[model samples]
Target: MENKNLIQKSIDTVRVLAADAVQKANSGHPGTPMSLAPLGHVLWSQVMHYNPENPDWANRDRFVLSCGHACMLQYSFLHLTGYKITLDDIKNFRQLHSITPGHPEYGMTPGIEVTTGPLGQGFANGVGMGIAQQYMAARYNKKDYSIFDYKIYTICSDGDLMEGVTAEAASLAGHLGLGNLIYFYDSNQITIEGGTDLAFDEDVSKRFESYGWHVQNLPDINDLDALSEAIKNAQQETGKPSLIKVRSHIGYGSPNKENTAEAHGSPLGKDEIRLVKEKFGFDPDKDFDISSEVSNFYLEAGRKSAENEQKWNELYENYKRAYPELATEYENIISGKFSEEWKEKLPVFDDEKPVATRKASGKVLNAIAEYLPQLVGGSADLSPSTNTVLEAFESFSPKNRDGRNFHFGIREHAMGAVLNGMVLSKYLIPYGATFLIFSDYMRPPLRLASIMKIRQIMVFTHDSIGLGEDGTTHQPVEQLIGLRSVPNMTVIRPADANETAHAWHVAIEHTDGPVALALTRQELPVIDQKKFASAENLEKGAYILSDSEGQPDVILMASGSEVQLILKAQEELKKNNISARVVSMPSWNLFDQQNDEYKEKVFPKAIRTRLAVEAGSTIGWMKYTTDGGDVIGIDRFGESAPADELFKEFGFTVENVVKKATALVSGNK
Candidate 1:
């Protein structure tokens, strides 16, 4: 607090850089970065544990800009603090191919923890980081050598809080008692519509407190001492997550637009910028300029982080000597490596007895859980429904940090974000589960998961109208198609218990992106062994389950609960003296990767009469359904009725499927 002028100058430097970038780009949010300058200064300089020179340092504390539109704040800080983001990159904000885009994307930008821009996602991603922290600490840290004691700090805005996803994640963070997670709420009281009071007047601090968070309020926006003290107090509270509400103006330095809505998005004119600089006692003409001394302040901060990392390295050496096996496991977890035996342990299902994919998923989870000790996750109050909870595994709770099962209450949005945080930790295979229909509530974070390409599992059960009396609200009609549309996402809808088991196996094997396994709530009859498709074929995306006796009439393709209908259709076609082939296409993305030879062999390049059957949308089935072929799919939303009634009414039946297949084969007149 002694070098108050220098500290204030450094903070003001961030504000100017933000304003300059927004003004130069002619588009971008200047309000947040300008207003929250002091808060960012305190967190980055005095609080965060990170090395700007080594942004990928494993044990460093993570800082997520959840309100990513305020990315100028982060880009400016990274440049001044010695990261790879150059001032030129700041000048090129919102331009094509630039690291600084409209939103903070992972892999594209250095020091960005998660690809955040869809409001509320960064906060949820922070929750995931907190989960990883606890799991790693419980598994790796020794009595004296606590190597992974790092916090995940998030800076969010009113829009972030207004979004429902953050509310769900905040509740889960509290439930887990993640003391290492700290959030700095930019209480700027303004929204695009003018003031937050016009739309959002609920007590945010009280809401977080209700979730058992340690809440603090800083009265003065520019008071670094007060902000620092509140942060320290929050850090000291051990059993709860923390939220520090820092009151700030939308544009803190600008003389006229400081607290106005105009500062929220539009850049202040050059004249106004000059006036703001004069107020801060800065040269009115200079742009993106900071004194070397002010920049060096953060360099010293970076050097301290490197020294801290070196100290941790020495302690870890001692830890390895004390617990060799555990240390090895810890290293593998951090490096994103699973045991070789984990691959071998994947269950193989067959068309033998009746089995629901959800039930099979439960069995597969237990088997894989046996081999991978670091696999941790739970359901969004749908453990029984999703069949994601493994038996004999400890539940992850405030009292039991070593447990694996996480009860995310009924908050689906939070579950997805928290899992992202856990995956971001790079030490645990985190998964979340819920009914497939509820995916709508979780899509924002789920989209971020695909963008981040983190290895997280989404065990979505109650797929389609097959979920029974749970009704239309619970049924997932468009969810499958919605998930499939996302690039880099693998959407797997298993037909039976065996396929469900195989889907889980493939999901874990996928290290590049997120996997959504849609399981059935109703029990499905396992296919006959000879008639069943190879689980290995799932990796190929699509394969022939029952082929035509010759280069014959029609090809029937389906997935998930509807694959059974395809089989029934095939049987009826055989009875009618027609030879039809059946294909179980569990994952289109995986199948699309197969060689053309394999694809042609299954669908036959010459056979043009095709019929695609699935309980969901037929939008993307045109590739398989040739010019004359038909698609037997639900084209509209489902109704609130018994699962059986919905399925019949919606035409998801063997009768309709067979009729369509027969017509396609005959080139229906």
Candidate 2:
């Protein structure tokens, strides 16, 4: 039926191009790409429905290279299939500012589905994409009009399967019955260290099957018909995700390193590459050689994909006329536009009642969820503790694909990666919640989300030592600073119920990067907005909440629950002829973005006597405190006690703040 000779020539083109790119760069893994070339050819030519001309087509199948070290494989496919990736781009692989980086970056490359370098992250991200696909299809698809049916395909390695995050994501994918997910496990049985037998020896096929996946094992990597048939079988089974364990060699044609660990990470020598090219029936002297016939074949495949996209565009037009409202909503979501009035839906909190910031976050989330249909997320089995559950929405499970709330079980690591995947789908505003301390477990995905600059909201409750009785292990002493250290991450610690509501507003509106909301488990007294500055000033990042007469003798600054103590200390200072100003610094990242005039206005260079208070690490307070000021924060781990007692023990009390401010003012004078 198909031209077997042409297909094999195309596969060799992929292999040769990838091996040449890695050999030129001298800094990449070439084995996986060489081994997976046939599979890549089959996917691009026969399976995937992607228009190289319009790589961002909404309904096109998503491909993620989970073994991102083998990114040359994806780069070769992109170049061959005419996705705007030029030959020069492949030649400059891993060079500075090149589109072909060591790993696949979402926005940098046209066809890259997600930014993936860390082993298990892309695997989990594929799960998130599967969830998003199911959600969109369930909500938008009608009878005889399947508008949103796209499969997510990931090529994963042994390292990806061995990671715990992948295990977590695989379990959840099975539980959700994400039939749209079809992953290829490259069973090369070689890690960076040696053979996988040195460490990993479990029956991976049985493992995925036990997790409720449709499992298939292929013994040959070069069998294009078998690979195509397996993919078709995977697509037919519409009740569970499919895992095809492909037994591939590390370096398929290399003479000396075909199945060796040496081929896993390093580039093959020029001589060895020539030998491999010779084995594949190519001229040994040729480098980066691509047959003209293979090039024409892939270009023809791209033309067919473009036709498929044209058909989808026609269907979308008719669907738009039939259901104008739903179509409008869909258009808005795909364009990443939210209603201007969505801000009006934020709830106003009453200052009379004390409320945990987490609880207030829940109310704000539910209130805004009504206006924002794109908002979708869940907690890491801490919905009750983190207060992230959307009360009106049903849980997202195998039975209900349209549900907004997801139960990620106890998988914090997978939750982070999945959130990135959902956001990468370009329609959903995804959020995930867990304790602030456990953010360490999810830092890889969180960092990747920042690097990718996707719209992800990370809600972290039990923020500090104030979350006592669970002791040091549960408390987050340095998590705030750690989150702040990331390049594009916005870490917001809300002072009260009002600020908590505003933080969510900022998170939803701030589309440039990920936002981390650090909330408290203990009830924090809401600042009376009428008496103090309006909570709307929170957009300024740091604002003068309560100022004294004249230039003020000292500035008392804090965030989260400690702001209440600073407010109380201001009253005590006023009684003792001390004019102290209280400043609520909710977000350092936001504050840094402000102009120097605004930053100086909030901190005020005239008032050098400043005292900062927080119930967490004191490392990053010096920037705000300056030379004449000091920070009063916990530098050590917390102890097992009541929250009130812990606050006092950690010197996070009104008395401690007053004493520190008094001494700073005296010394400054």
Candidate 3:
């Protein structure tokens, strides 16, 4: 009991802080934090190694709160430890402009590893972090150097385990033997709606074991010794990820709310808080209470952890001498820069023969894989179809951690989250792929990546009805606009091989957000750089591919496969003695970034009779197509037929485009 008083007091402080913060905010989940306080104290104050002074220390362990609603648990510990967060910040929980938002956000909060509030997202994100640790260890760790040995620790809830993404990530983690990942299931048997018995009841430990994880079930979370031992044992298992299931009361120490849903979401009343504070041996009148003893204990814990980084820094100096090149490369990646010469390795497509943009993307990946070793990825079991394979690399697996190609199976949502987690490492520029139709499954991570402002690539292929024979269910008629709908998300629909190459270049160079390459399965005619504007104009988003002799009567604009149709239609319009300018509008987001002068030059003020033809939804096209202009796009779902047939049926043809241009030119639109 010598150490029990200080540790228990520290855990009790976490509980009271949760209680006080939620009571002040008048909203937010309180019970999960109260219940998991012991786990939080053990993990943050004892088990996890990190210099609170440097939350971003290269080799510091990562902590992901998968049960992000229990963010008070994270926030309380963050404050007590020597992180940037303060008690005042905790008091302002869920308030406007506060770092302590309802859910823990990565960049917003000092200690938060990833922005996680979406259930199960953090669970998958931790798996991605595990993959990153494994990859970095394989890439940088020398025989004696032990660099990149940091582990990923996460706390998930029953709700997290119930989410499908969690299952997908768990299975992949087990398959790859991510022994560095340790997850704690705060099995308080409570959720916001009601008791988990109302919906969820399954053998969670058995399930994780089936997924090949090392499983340990602790009967009580209050038994701090057992929690520490389980974590230690988890670290000892070096071949599989581990899960510790802790049984605990929801609002531990609450007179009436413990083990009840009432405490799970809403704040406990003043009387209840007072009662709990008294029970924990605190001044019953005080709110947001942190006793002197508890504060000193955690402060000392934080100070002691700084030694981990100091030791790692020394080892790093030795590592540099032993592995000079690898050391420089590691430094470059963590600083988020890479050899600019990789740009030269980007293959150029000069052939006039039609080539699928997806195939072009594959060529780009293969051409630069050796030069850009950090550019690692594979498709969601659709590598052959999505063409996301790095041909020269072996699959990343249990035996081969150095492999660049990751077979993320058919789990699209988990793959997106995993990629998010992997990119969290300053070392890997990861990407994932699937059909555009399947992106619906991966929207959470896609949005999270943008929110965190993480730079990664997503190859979304079979972009439109042109994916033929896939039927309406497989074809993505609205996905283009859907992705564009996400703020800060850059969606690039490359018209052909050359444009696709530039899209990848833009994706790598642009560092602010995630870039989705919406590529075509059907072959598109290569736009010759000599005959028209350069494909390099793709960086500008929308460019005048081919122009009219003077101020054209009608302007023709399109993206992806339809660009060829508009080019042909421009000629058709010219044959009819009607002047028309053809514009290749590949990326709306990029084009928006261009100056007004450039936008006006591309869409001249005199050109109101413009026609925008695309194979997908016409939702966001009106910005380019003036009031007098029209858009030829699929307002309905696609059909099961040949790509050519679907294009024709949907009015995505040269004949139809010419007709629309004639009508607009004739003032009949």
Candidate 4:
């Protein structure tokens, strides 16, 4: 067994590096890294199964620092353990272009698993990573070779524990029985303002216990053996996640700022630095010191990691020989390749069999899920209503990781953050669903996913006033526009079932960033093939569903349920001896991606009389509607009545849309 004295020395090594780095940079949170040093050392050196040499190894353990303010502690460990992080990187901490930043970002740093700093995001993400591991192990792991057997470990603080998202994720983790998920709570009893008692005084261990987690308390922060034993106990508990509350003083050994909020952030002054260095038995005059013995100790961990990788490779070779087809799929998933057969499997919609885009979306998801086994997701208590659940797949429960469905309950915010973590794991295609109105609750994670360019899916249903009876609270009036505003985020509001299927088709194939599918609740009439074009044109953003004889005087543009309204208006215009064109604009972002020539061809400038209508906010319609164009849309919150009444009260009738179109045509004439 590693001696307690040796572990304490290692922890001191981590603490001193953090203190020196913060002191040198004249910035950063010193208290967390200083206090959590012993716990981090215990977990990384003794319990965690990560390979510092190959941070991208598929089956290696995942580590997330939920308390991202304490990034220096992670950087110090990475530097000492011989990961890509260097002492120089730590010196340049929080610099403009340096790898070491204020927070731990997934792709930016070598060992960071998820981009964290947003309070409970890292903890929520850890829950997601645990879920991904369970699904991967269930789907691919053979009896002899434990290919996907890995744990997700995270170190969080009072801020992370206090966030509502953390509570939601913890509940879900317990319900799923993610035994491999272990979290180390740094119980320093200090926050930025002062003690946690100021704003957060809840008993964290009891709260986690309520969430069905096995809670353990380590009275001594310096007790490495006890910490390891607690982890062992957690690993042995096959039906519950574990939370270890480590009681420790913030900035332990620091003479002046120990246990004070002053140590939470900001660099210790040069004088205080000298005192800490003297206490750690380091040269007060020198900075960034790593004893030769300490450096050599970490090199052993690197060598052991390489050897473990080699063993896994040999096992995989034998497994490949035994199961060739499964091996090919595994390699493809790891390599981020999808068979063309998967695309061929995507359902094609005919205009004659008009279906609600949400229904089509569900079909597309089911088809893609059949080929891409890594695809795993759930709705925020709206699985059946959102049409996001896979029919044949089982629910992800405490006892079984093989289940495909995720029951997120009512926690939209946590579900979103958890999805981000799963995507960061690189083993599962994570997605979340809820009513479009509830998107406001989950916007933070959604924005973070966009900023990180993570390929996660968000299914938003009950898109507009068409949701009915649920009132303005349930119906989303501005959400579509709000979601569409996010850079690199593809928002698809499918018109009919075929378009919805195509939207999912594009969503799954897109590997760059996040994709959100906005779906409707009501059934839509299927456009006749003889009268309307195929739904494949939906990829163009705006496609002419029905056209006039020649150079139409007016054009009608709409999306989702409103597309049928424009079509009805077009028929009425034709009967009145007026030439009108109907366009279905399913996704404005995808359409903007289309070539300029294609855009102009779809919306001819010659037809200056354009009318756009939808049952949502009008803020986004200015782009489609030109100077002479008119938009018939809801400008304010909807009413608490039936969807049909709301639509009528909101003036979402074909007559109103036709009136706008007729006025534009008359002006053109």
TM-score of each: 0.96, 0.98, 0.99, 0.94
Query: What is candidate 1's local distance difference test score?
Result: 0.84
Candidates 1 and 2 compared by lDDT, better number? 2
Residue-level lDDT of model 4, residues 336-421, one tens digit each, is 89877777888765544556667777888887787878888889888888888899898888766788888889999999999998
For model 4, which pairs clash? 176-398, 354-526, 355-497
Candidate 3 similarity to native, TM-score: 0.99
Residue-level lDDT tens digits of model 3 in 459-519:
9999999889979999998889999988889999988899999999999777788999999
Off by over 4 Å in 2: none
Q: Which candidate model has the greater TM-score, 1 or 2? A: 2
RMSD of each: 2.1, 1.3, 1.2, 2.6
Clashes of each: 7, 0, 0, 3
The list of candidate 3 runs beyond 4 A from truth reads none
Better of 1 and 3 by lDDT: 3
- lDDT (C-alpha) at residue 161 in model 2: 95
Query: Which structure among the candidates has the greatest lDDT?
Result: 2
Query: Where in model 4 is the C-alpha error above 4 Å?
Result: 1-9, 351-354, 574-578, 603-609, 665-669
lDDT of 2 by residue, 1-669 (tens): 268877887887788888889999998999999899999988988889999999999999999999899999999988888899999999999999999999999899999989998999999999999999999998999887789999999999999999999999999999889999999999999998998999999999999999999999999988888999999999999999999999999888899999998888898999999898998899989788988888889888888877889999999999998889999999987876788777888888864589999999999998889788789999999999999888889888889988999899999999999999999888999999999999999999999999999889999999998888999899999999999999999999999999998999899888888999999999988889889998887877889999998789999899899899999999999999999889999999999999999888888888788989988889999988999999998888899899999888878878888888999888977
Q: lDDT (CA) for every model shown?
A: 0.84, 0.91, 0.90, 0.84
